[model samples]
Target: MPKIDVLAPRSAYDIECETLIIGAGACGMVAALSAHQQGEQVLVVEADAVPSGSTALSAGLIPAAGTSIQRAAGINDSAELFARDIQAKAQGENDQALVDQIATDAAEVIDWLAQAHGLPFSVVSNFDYPGHSRRRMHGLPTRSGAELIDALRARCEALEIDIICERRAFALFHEAGEVTGVAVSTPDNTQETIKCARLILACNGFGGNRELVGQHMPEIKYGLWFGHDGNKGEAILWADKIGAQVTHLGAYQGHGNVAHPHGILITWAVITEGGFQVNKDGRRFWNEAQGYSEAARAVLSQPDGEAFAIFDERIAGIARQFEDFKKAEAVGAIKSSNTLEDLAEQLGLPAQALRETHADLPLGETDGFGRTFGDVPLSAPYVGVRVTGALFHTQGGLKTDTSGRVLKTSGQAFRTLFAGGGAACGVSGSNDSGYLSGNGLLSAMVLGRNAGKA
Candidate 1:
């Protein structure tokens, strides 16, 4: 039911701009900034009063190779290795050319944000994500998506770029296969049409649309939708009406560790730092190191659709860098105990099964799931959080060329149409398991930069 209305072009408009961007999230903001840098009159519109989308709900880290932040942190990484990591994780299911382009352009995008926009970015060298070979994640001081969005919004403000919030674009107007303008409505149901030479769709994916999720990704249809509510498949709907080529409709990003009832995101650092997850029965289910995106189905399949993330104080210390983790702690979502037995009792898990599960952690060899435990094991005092699986956002949308130009089914580019972020087919291939850490922002910012440059 939430679809973009396609209409014919009108002679006049309420506003005009050289380039118009839909959605004020990371992708849209980046595109607006990039276009502004090229002396293009850019205007950004958002459905909400402020720019808070899926990016704000994330950890706000973007993976980039060969960045100054990485060099300053003494990390040796390159675009080729990053591309290989993506391809390996996706099992070569994604487009190699697009992967390479995104990988190569990533560092430039990071550097540009810091030097040009004055966004303080630093490489997250504390630990490596699942598929990445090196530590290349870059984030702001808070290491939160909200901080990233605020910084981008501030940069837009400093540049005098107009960002009109609370204006939802509901209709797209085109003439002779070229996008001409869009129809937007305000909170009071007042309508306005804006004409633009070029249009970029950065409105994100359809994870919030229950019907679209049931149609494309029924696997997580019943799971919690943890993304922005405005992501209702408008970009995909517009693309469909315009006959744009779409691919990887089933690709999405899922998480297995949203704090139950509190609804806060628990960073994967707990698991990566030697913590483990157990079902309500206090039995370890699968290899958590396989990556968080695939863990959604694993966690959801358990009894009662819930699990407990078990970790120690040292791991919790590392996780404290995330604002979400701190919020979860403040809200009492995290429970701490001095011993495994006490922790099991607090979580209502079977003490004996939890002890056996903890004892099975291999120190030398790989476990059944091929995850190797380090010499340092979880010790007292122990910490645990009740968590459930959630659908973060969809990873697939309109198929585009390397430059972020939306293409028709016949492989021809639309003269004035572009897409980025969740509106574009991502590099995650065709499934949740293919998602690497920071892949969502990678597509969002890089493709957004491309669209703006175009």
Candidate 2:
């Protein structure tokens, strides 16, 4: 975990509430809002000045089935289908009951956030994310996580829930082995104990902690960490101290193409639309169709820890719908050339190597990396983005039940202790390859609402 300060003895309670939430991300805010809606007093504390966690860095997509939106779109879906999809992608290594619960509750939670809470979410159609059989993803009008967080924060404010920002929660406070509250260190370096009837650990995972990353997920330990700095795995560490069972510690979401210097996420739509990645040596290294999270491993193992996303104008037009793509283009993160030789000269790649690579783009022709480019050859005017792999967020932490109660090693619920969002072990199972798109927020919002309701 990120280096936490040793605490001094707490003398008295600084605040008390019915429900205490650690972290102000989507999960924490949703939990707080849900609890407040139920007429319970809630308090949320954030480690940073504002409430942007990895959720704010995401595309704000949440997968759900049987929602009003889905039904209105005439797409048939069921919780069973959603659970099966998750199990298929996670290789059946997930908690079955939790998966079922998330699938069942996802639509209701998102629909509530939209209709009642005024968070404008609409079902996105005509496209498919990796590991989903149908169009089950819902996103904001802006398709930005920052906007989603703002909506949740506004709901919390409307409920008059207290949110303490820039305060770091260090440890859990317990009485007679029952979790009761949290110990927080404020910006002034003073220790304050906030006692509560229930505690929700939403402090995210260890993507930013080098030691924890090496210990749990050594495969991507050396990859660039692209998550929030405040995600120091404190929830995992503190819950472990209280005998909380940790599961799926190696699971994470890895982005294959984070445009360098510009730092904008290069959408995988480029690859799905017939774009290919090449090593710094100007050669295909792996099947680009493996999806982003899985392809990250191949990208990291490249010759110089670098790769380039090469696509034609047709694919670029398809990808321009994403805000990150628009921003990347605005910042000059993408370059274009009308010819392979000009493209090679502009990007410093081998012209002959690039030309030869495109010669075999016909259907049923497999490249050296076992990739079949069935979409025919890429058009003349080419677009390319210099890219690198990055760890976006961890999908593992404290194991919880269907209702979001943190479970002990003996399989009993830890009384008064709850976890969700990045603080909870997710549906991604035991490794990075199992990560399906939108799994992070699915686990977060579903479990967060569950914890608050319980």
Candidate 3:
């Protein structure tokens, strides 16, 4: 018989632990750390490298509702109030209970990010991203995910948590009705079974998963929503196989942006911060600060979720006109145009109309005509990026309670399965980016920690 015969009598590489976490992104990493601290032996098995996935792509701001920070800041928030706010604001879309729990712990999670990782941040009370309440956003200086990952990675390593990367989990292990472990496809194409009394499905969403997207957000059937190619709804698929209940199937966040040559749209975390948008004809769109989410809706409602990121050498010249477009330029903010002809041509707009359109307009800034990066709009180097909207992250996912407990389809508890972060159902889908701060990371940290602790 061949060494790898038909059934090979259950592999010898099986392993066991107290908790087995899938995906090592922010959510999974935080969950592992939390579970480990609770005296549970934890293991994290990821399909990619550690600290990768959407967490790597995220801005990494952890925002919660009622915490010492929010209280001290005089933000008057509570779990009940938070839940009500999320539910009410979401228009009965996202899961009320989960949103409530996240709001409950919003600030403490950010505090943990600062205290645990030395990630510096300061509150911008009355601050607004685009959608949420005024100035409640607490911002990190860097506004990047690397800072948060550094903290999470170190903690997991110190706790001696086993992090197995490139291991593709194929099936959940179960006996009777409880999920006991998972069967994963190893890098060598071999199989291994890992065991645990508890499992955390922090593998993220189906936004990148075409099948999932098509089935749920059918409006996006032909729509483009920039998402990781690797996110194929494996978590949702796995959840389904285990008979786990899933809801909020139609909900998804819109991220409209300029499409790059890479098939990925170059939208922004906050266009209201940099500048405003203009159609291909050099016509200004909506109010810059008024409902920045209008961009998301506006972009999607168009022929394509396409728009030209209109900026001028003049606004580019204004250093403080915006944040720091120069640094952003170095980081590849968007494309530019000097003469409207070239910009229109590059972005597929009518050149004569664009020029004629601007010829009669006031040359100086008038309340908000074009991009105001800073200074006097430099000179020529005007730019624009052809962009579109993408699914970003799917809002609907596994249902959880106020404590991040995985709720069964039957409205009962699903033993050993807990979900949070993007993998969990319920998000404030008022559909505005740059509206609030730290929602993704904060939700993960707060719920992940609580679930582990519970």
Query: Highest TM-score, which number?
Result: 1
The TM-score values for the models, in the order shown, are 0.98, 0.95, 0.78
Look at candidate 1 and give me any clashing residue pairs.
Answer: none
Q: Could you arrange the candidates by TM-score from highest to lowest?
A: 1, 2, 3
lDDT by residue (1-454, candidate 3, tens digit) is 0121112223343797888888787888877877877888888888875557776555555555555566677777555655554555566666555666577666666676567645566555522454454345554554455555666787778768889888867677665556777777777778788777788877777777777777776666556655445566665665555567777766655555534433433324334434455565556565444332335566666654566655555434432222323335555545566677887777778888766544543334444434333223323676666655555566667778867778776688887888877777646453443223345566667777777777
Q: lDDT per model, in order?
A: 0.93, 0.85, 0.61
Give the distance in Å from residue 342's predicted Cα in candidate 3 to where it truly belongs.
Answer: 7.8
In candidate 2 the C-alpha lDDT for residue 152 amounts to 88
lDDT: worst 10-residue window of model 2: 1-10
lDDT of 3: 0.61
Point out the higher-scoring one by lDDT: 1 or 3: 1
Error of 3 at 131 (Å): 1.8
Question: What stretches of model 3 exceed 4 Å from their correct place?
Answer: 1-13, 65-85, 124-127, 138-140, 262-270, 284-297, 300-305, 311-328, 331-384, 429-438
